[model samples]
Target: MKRLIAWISDLRLAIGLLILIAIASGLGTLVPQQESAELYHRVYDAQPWLGLLNGNAILRLQLDHVYSSSWFLGLLAWLGLSLILCSWRRQWPALQAALRWIDYSSPRQLSKLNLAETLSCSDASQELQRLEDLLSQRGWQVQPHPDRLAARRGASGRVGPLLVHAGLVVLMVGAAWGALAGQRLERFLAPGNELELVNRRGETQLTVALEGFGIERDPAGRPEQFRSQLRLQPGDPNAAVPLPASTETISVNHPLRFQGMTVYQADWALAAIQVQLGQSPILELPLQSFPQLGDQVWGIVLPTRPDGSNPVLLALSSEQGPVTAYSAEAEILGTLVPGGGPAEIAGIPLRIAGVVPASGLLLKRDPGVPLVYAGFAIALAGGALSLIATRQLWAIAEPKQHKLHVAGLCNRNLAAFSRELPALLTELQQG
Candidate 1:
């Protein structure tokens, strides 16, 4: 049992686990997560990056949702346990040892340290007092003994490793919590549309109202940027009837943060278009993607007669362009530009009216985001603290022999400490 505990607490084991987790995270980034099974099948069947592994294999291994997978969560749990065990078995004890003073009976004991030096003095008692004063001035915690003195500097450096491990554990816990309970929602909403924020349990928490959506297009008629004007209400959907004063504008790279949720403008699409069919009512037809026709093109099929006969396909690539009318035989019938007069297509007059644009908003709520940010801050502070060298000095003053035996040790930056120690000892001996 002791051996098992030691193995689990080993630094090598922790490093290996961290490397494995990094590799798994990389793989997870490569694979899209939480997509529909049909999308996975269609994507993988078309371009199978991994040979002999299809969508079924991906689903079986839970690779589609890697962060939420049992194996990934288990890895996080194991790493957290390892950090706790390692801190308990090693860092805590080391910190305690660093904080406590270890009195050396003789200067010879201090001489055995990793980086040690000896200093001689003419008047042992007077020199020892001077050295103690100097050490105190330099922020060293001094412990006086009958014949000797033990002084330590940077004792707090020992706590760095502990904080580092603690921060790592906290970060892991935050990530796990986010994977388990965080919410993500992506929706295409038209201007003036409102939706209630719902959790995984389908409980409405808040209301999001879209005031306006606009798409900035390039000279080539391609969308360069998409922006959404939004208003957030505190209560449920019904409570937002009068609208709220809390409004925010979100663009492509910029997002709006409210409460614990973030709203990102992800994409844009053509929602619907108004069309008039020969003295008939102006029909608002919802457009659907027709990738087979052209890129970024949307189309709709409308019947010429009220009896639903002679269906014709109307396709448009952009809102600014001409809409091509196609006959039932896949032949071009006529073209009508936006706001242009009615054109004859299969003996029916058609006119292209206005187009409605929709904005794609991605909402995310991660309860653990604050914890994760805090953990990272603590880790950075600990890393900076670890850079400081913990140094200790022991001195034995033999007044009868008129000799002071001084020895010094440093855990890190020994060369600099070595030069500084001699200079300090020389100053004390001269005084």
Candidate 2:
């Protein structure tokens, strides 16, 4: 058991696991993952070799669905295990050493350490106390030993690896949670239409009503902006509360958020006509609602009598007379003739005027977003401190014959340290 633990705790194992994770995660971003049957078929049709990629064995192994595949999750699990084991074994000793008080006694031993400072001070204790005070003032906890002073500072270095590990765990957990549980829904609404967004599970819901939508354009007529006026309501249909009007409007690049859900302007599309039928005409009618192409609506208009015995209506010019139509439907419409045909337009009992194009909006809700944000914040802060803020110490003391010994150490930026150390030592000696 001890040998097994030791082998697993090796840095090589941890590094290998990390490399494997990076490779797998990179592949996740590179490949088009399993989405739907049609998308899979489309991909295979586009790249015929894609079918061979998932040989029957590989398909069952779930390589196509890499992100959520058991092997991928298992790789992540192994990564987590490797981090915990390696940190526990390697960092445990350094953490103990950093936490323990340093013993700074034995003048002879200190002199041999290449940093010994022999001071000409009549009051050694006072100078030592001052040094201790200075170090403490600079955020280092200090302790005095029998022959000399002992201090162990920056013990927090011990926590750096642990912090990074914790952040990785939190980040991974948050991302996995989001992948499994985050909800996204898209809706298209005209100027006055209302929409209710449903979650992936279809359990939770939210409603948004569009008050208006418009496009802004530059002086040259190219579109410069698009905007939407919306109302957000929370809770069930009956007990919902509407948000303030000022909060309802969202423009390009601006999004609306309410109850932890965000709504963004996605796209827009033109609206179409709706049609209905009534009980009594024997005549055949042409398509009343024409499909619009660009901004224009075009269609063929043919006319027939209600009894179907009349010839089709065609526009023809008479000799210097107004354009005449040679069908009974047009002639019938001239007089107050009654016909048994559709009572209303489309299936609705009313005629539809031109429609205002609808604007599509995307709504997204994620509960683990806060955790991911916190993890990123922690990683950034830790990384910045590790890269920028560093510890340094310069010591100078004069011994016999006006000779002074100076020693210095810096925790980071060694090149800067080397340049500054000589200047500091020279200044100390001259002073």
Candidate 3:
């Protein structure tokens, strides 16, 4: 068990784990994931090896969803466990050793130490008091040691390991939660389409109504801007309605939040529909015979008159289609019908109906947002604190000779400490 613990504490194992994490992160960036199996097949057609990772094996097991994978989760759990154990095994003993004080009887032992400074004083008590005061003034929290006036400070430094470990664990937990519980859904509308928010887990629990959509163009005739205005509503329309004043609007970058749901501006399309009114000979109505055509022009049939006459016909076509009369302007006498001119196309009426426009929307919901943010904040703080602050102080005293010694040490950025030690020693000497 001791050997096992020691092996786990080895820096090499930690480095290997780091390498694996790097590979996973690299794979996540290289491969497109979080999409359906068909999309994966499309993306990885050239790399047959990747085909093995498709379907439910990738999705259900979360290999494609790397951040949420069980293996990734297990890796994080192991990392946390290792960090806690290593801290207890290594830092705890080191900290205890630092806290322990020994009466220095021989100068040889004191000289063997790193950064030892011995000063002879007539009144050791007054010097010790002044030294304590100086250390306290310099932001060092002083504590007495066993043998003599061993002023230990910066005890909070011990928490650095725990802080880093906790931060990493929280960060991993937050990422996992987001991968499992957050979602993105897209809906298309012309100018008036509505939809509900869907989470990563494939659940829709909130709805949003699109109030308006705006489009803008640039000098080059490309789409420079797309904006959408939306209002949030309770998914259940029959429930006690919320105040109308509470409705919020959202656009592309600006997302509207309601009841833990968010609605974004995703995309849109135009739909062209034909309208018509009744009866003509099967040959007379080109549209009645064919519902959909390679050419999009459609003919509408309307209600017949009191007399046994042909009904109104409205032919509608998109910008792509060009309309032509069967005869020259002078010869085309009476294909024209009602609202404006003569009505004699087999005694029928004809007119153009206005075009209609529709709109599109996107929705999202993330229950783990707060957790993710908290984890990031903690990790960032730990990184900053670990780099800037560390603990190192030592003191030695003998009861017989009433002489005292003190020193400081650090594992990193030693040059800065070495430079600062002279000044620190000067302050101690003045006492």
Candidate 4:
């Protein structure tokens, strides 16, 4: 049992676990996570990732969702175990030892320390008292004994490593908790469309509407950013308190945070086309993706003749118009811009009214996010606290020999502390 504990608390084991977690996290970043199986097949089936991982292999190994994978969670658990063991076995004991004062009784005992000094004094007892009083004034916690005195400063530094381990454990636990119970939903909705949100029990909790969407473009007509305006309202019919409706805008990195959920604007797509044929009512045709033509191309078929013969394929890539019409022979019949004049395709007047676009929003809710944030704050504070130098001072008064012995130790910055030791002795004698 002792050997097993020693191995678990080993520094090298902890470092190895950290490295593994980092590598796994990097792999997760490289792979697109939580995508549809069709996407995985399309992307990884033909050209396997890393020349080894095919879609089948990825799905089987749960690589498609690495952060939430069992193996990844196990790695986090193992790391947390190492941190807990190291803290319990080593850091806690060291902190306890630092907090406890130890007395040194003689000059020979004082000389055993790294930095020590002995000075002749007219009144050794008075000097010892003065030294204790001065150390207390200098923010040292002094403990006086019959023949010796021990004091410590920056004892809080000993707690830093323990806090670091605790913080890391909390971080891993929070991440694991989020992976196990967090919720995520991705939706592509046209403007003025609403998406329903549900809780863990699958009851409706809220409704979010895509009130507006716009794309900022460069002078060269390339989209720079996609922005979506959203309106949120409570949807539960059995709720006691009425939740007020709220409106907000979200973009790629700027997400809307509300009631423990975050809504991100992820992607944009051409949804539909509005067109008028002769004196017919304006027909809004839903667009279908034409991946063979281009990544962003969408198409809809329109009858050009009264007999429903010689149908025209209307395709558009963007909302900033110029839709192309293709005949059955795969020849371009005409190009009509939105709000432009009617185009004669097979002798039928067709005019493009407008384009409808959809915004892809990804919503997520994680209860562990607050815990993760707290762990981050704790780790940061621990890192800063670890830099403080823990210094210990010991003194002994020998009235018979008319001598005062002083010894000091600092956990870090020994060279500077060594230089300061002699000055500290001088102050002790002068006092």
| Per-residue lDDT of model 1, residues 1-431, tens digit only | 88998898889998999998998898799988888999778778767747766788888889899988999999989988989999999999999988878888876776687655555556788778888899899888999887789998887788899999888888888998999999888888888899897655776677888999988898887789988999887664456374445889999889988888999998887888889978978888899989788768888999988799999998887767678888889999998898889999889878888788788999999988888888898888888889889998888888887777778788888999889888888888777
Residue 409 of candidate 3: its Cα lDDT? 66
- TM-score per candidate, chains pooled: 0.89, 0.63, 0.66, 0.92
Q: Return the TM-score for candidate 2, rounded to 2 decimals.
A: 0.63
| Runs in model 4 lying further than 4 Å from the true structure | 199-202, 240-243, 301-313, 326-333, 345-348, 429-431
Candidate 4 lDDT, 288-349, residue by residue in tens = 89988888899998776678888989988888878999999899999999988898877888
Error of 1 at 341 (Å): 5.1
Candidate 3 RMSD to the real structure? 9.3
After superposition, candidate 2 runs with Cα above 4 Å error: 1-35, 48-72, 111-130, 133-140, 151-158, 198-204, 215-225, 237-247, 271-356, 388-411, 414-431
lDDT of 4 at 73: 95
Error of 1 at 302 (Å): 3.7
Task: Give the range where candidate 4 is weakest over 10 consecutive residues by summed lDDT.
Answer: 422-431
How many residue pairs in model 2 have overlapping backbones? Answer: 4
Residue 207 error for model 1, in Å?
2.1
Please give the lDDT score for candidate 1: 0.85
Instruction: Tell me which residue pairs clash in candidate 2.
Output: 275-346, 275-347, 276-346, 276-347
After superposition, candidate 1 runs with Cα above 4 Å error: 198-203, 218-222, 236-245, 293-295, 303-312, 316-319, 322-337, 340-349
Count of clashes in candidate 4: 0
- The model with the greater lDDT, 1 or 2, is 1
> Is 2 or 4 the stronger prediction by TM-score?
4
Model 3 residue runs over 4 Å out of place are: 1-10, 42-64, 69-81, 84-88, 91-109, 144-147, 197-205, 236-246, 266-360, 395-404, 428-431
Model 1, residue pairs in steric clash: none
